[model samples]
Target: MRTLVIGDIHGGYKALLQVLERANVTKEDTLIFLGDYVDGWSQSAETIQYLIELSEKQQCIFIKGNHDVWCHEWLLNPEIENHIWFRNGGKETITSYLTNNFDTIAHLEFYKTLKNYYVDKKNRLFIHAGFSSMKGPANEVYLTNYRWDRTLWEMAIVMDKRVKKHSSLYPNRLKLYSEIYIGHTPTLHYDTDVPMQGINVWNIDTGAAFTGKLTILDIDTKEFWQSDPLPNLYPDEKGRN
Candidate 1:
């Protein structure tokens, strides 16, 4: 069974479908979505519905992104004003549900069930974002940092490869996992639109929320697939601009 790790979707349902189709995911495969499933594009509601259906048919693991958490709060109380969310693609998500008149209970349930992080038997860590504390993935670290921190990735980007010396200075950060997978910081930030590898961390967020594509990688083989550039797919709309 193939283990596929997908990056942030950000309401690009067409991109999401294309990436899934390109990967040829099967029932036996395990799909790990790194969150931000909603917001950005005009199809956030459709994206959530598709994921809910997909989960019933496969082994799907969902990680809660900051956007997902904000969306959850809004779903529970639509009247709440969150300028940050609304400005950063939340308006589109709201329009989708309002236009479609969807019963969002199922979607809410899915969001509520999402995990902050996941660690497989191989000791590979999957999280929406990284942690702030130098401490590795543990219960003691602040949970919110798991979905908001960027320093962890930044540190890994310039880490020393000498295991012994590095482990001595950053024991908590170094000794925990065999590899890490994260998706909150888009690869576009580095002026690239593909998955990036830094030391032992793999960043799969190719910026589907903006002009980049959605990416999916096989955890074991490191093989990957990407959707077409999102701007091309949604030619008429401005995505999170």
Candidate 2:
């Protein structure tokens, strides 16, 4: 029973599928998606549908990302204007929905149903972004505050940075239950730095939407697998023209 922790998909369904095939994931394997499942790429709708089906077939845990929350808000109440989604690859997601003529209500409900954070039986934590407050170690953070509170988000960022610096100096400052798995911040490497724990909090977002590799981490062995690089779906102004 291998537990696979996947980073942000960001609508790169092709890359995701390739990674899954490479991993040879099965029903016995639990998949924890760290959020940002949609947006950025052109296949947002397709990605969501794939995830929906995957969730039904396997042991899957879907966490809400900042982009997911934005999409939910816009889909449920578009009249109530918000820029968070639009600024962060929301336009691509909206375009995908409109192009596919998807049922808005159904999609919105799916997004609403997603959990903001997840804690495993081993007490390992997973979130889209960083946590608000972690009590003992990376795994014992308050899920509610980590997911929904704005103040906690601000403090978490600060603490995370501090921990990252300290961890480098004192390699074994603390060891919580297991470790926290997160996405949202794309990194060139599979395991980036976090305060206090050095590489305690693993970041798997390999920036697939930016034509980068898609990453998946094997929970038991802590091994990482990646898909072949793809073209950036949403290139910068220089590449757009």
Candidate 3:
């Protein structure tokens, strides 16, 4: 079975569908999503609803992103707004729920069930963001780092190429996994619109929240597919701006 890992969606349901279609994903495949499912464009609620239903039909692993945590908190207490979250795409997500007919109960449950991270039998690590511990994510001291950390990816990107994995200079955190996949920090930050591969860490968040396209990477083959730029898909909205 193919193992496909999807990147940060940021409420671009149209982009999600386009990437899945472009990738020709099958029910037999294992789909791993790197979260941030809501809080961006006009279809945040629809995206969550679709994912809830999709999980029932196929094998899917959903990692909780920082944005997803904020969205979940707001869902639990819709009345009292989290000002920080609201300023950063939460308003758009709330607006989607108000205008859409999604099942809030199921979506909330889905949020509750999201894994902070997932490790495949092949020893690949799938996380929304990064983990700081050398012992891996399971022993992470600050669980919030699973959704908010960027240091892991940062270290991977800047490591000296000459430092062999066996060398003491190599990072022990990265040494624990065969490969690591993450999506909190957008690749667009580095001016790329595609997945950024750093040693064994792959950053698949192609800035779908802003101007880049939604991306899906085939973990085994390293082949990937992307939707049209998110801005093009939702011309009328300013996603996560």
Candidate 4:
């Protein structure tokens, strides 16, 4: 069985489908989603529906993202106008649900069931966002940081490349994992639209919510598949702008 890890989807349902088809996933495969499944694009409801259906048929691991958390809060209290969420594509998601009469209750439950992170037998860590105070997988000062922090990735990016010295200095930074996979912070921000790897940490959010493509990487083989650039798929979309 293969382990496929997908990056932030951000409501790009068409892109998500393309990546899945390109990856050729099967029932035996382990599907790991890095989250941000809602918000952005025009089909958040449809995206969640497909994900719910996919989970029923396969071994699926859903990691909660910051956007997902915002969505969860909004779902639980729709009367509270969350300006931040609404400005950042939440409006589109709500519209989709209202238009389709989607099952908000089931979707909310699905969100509640998502994990903040997952560690495989191999000690590979999968998280929506890396934590600033992540001493180890089991030690985090603020649990929500696991889905909202970008300091870990930033630290990894600026850390010295000397493997030995870097490891010695920040021994606990990512020492608990053989490798770390994260989303939330798009790789495109660093000028690359593909996964960025540094010191055993991999940033796989290729900014599919913006102009970048959706990416899926095989945890073992490291082989990856990407959907076409999102702007091409939805020409008039502003996505996460």
- Overall lDDT per candidate, in order of appearance: 0.90, 0.67, 0.93, 0.88
Of the two candidates 1 and 4, the one with more favorable lDDT, higher being better, is 1
Residues 140-226 of candidate 3 have per-residue lDDT tens digits of: 999999999999999999988889889999899989999999999999999999999888999999999999999999999999999
Cα RMSDs, all models? 1.6, 5.6, 0.8, 1.5
Please provide TM-scores, in order, for all candidate models, with all chains considered together. 0.95, 0.76, 0.98, 0.95
User: 148-172 in candidate 2: lDDT tens per residue?
Assistant: 4433223333454445534554233
Clashes of 1: 0
For model 3 the local lDDT of residue 145 reads: 98
**Each candidate structure's count of clashing pairs:** 0, 5, 0, 0
Model 2 segments more than 4 A misplaced: 134-175, 189-197, 232-241
How far out, in Å, is residue 74 in model 1?
0.6
What is the descending lDDT order? 3, 1, 4, 2
Ordered by TM-score, highest first, the candidates read 3, 4, 1, 2
Residue-wise C-alpha lDDT for candidate 4, range 36-138, written one tens digit per residue: 9989999888999999999999999999998898888888888878898999999988887778876888999999999989998998999999876546746
Number of the top lDDT candidate = 3
Candidate 1, residue 188: the lDDT equals: 92
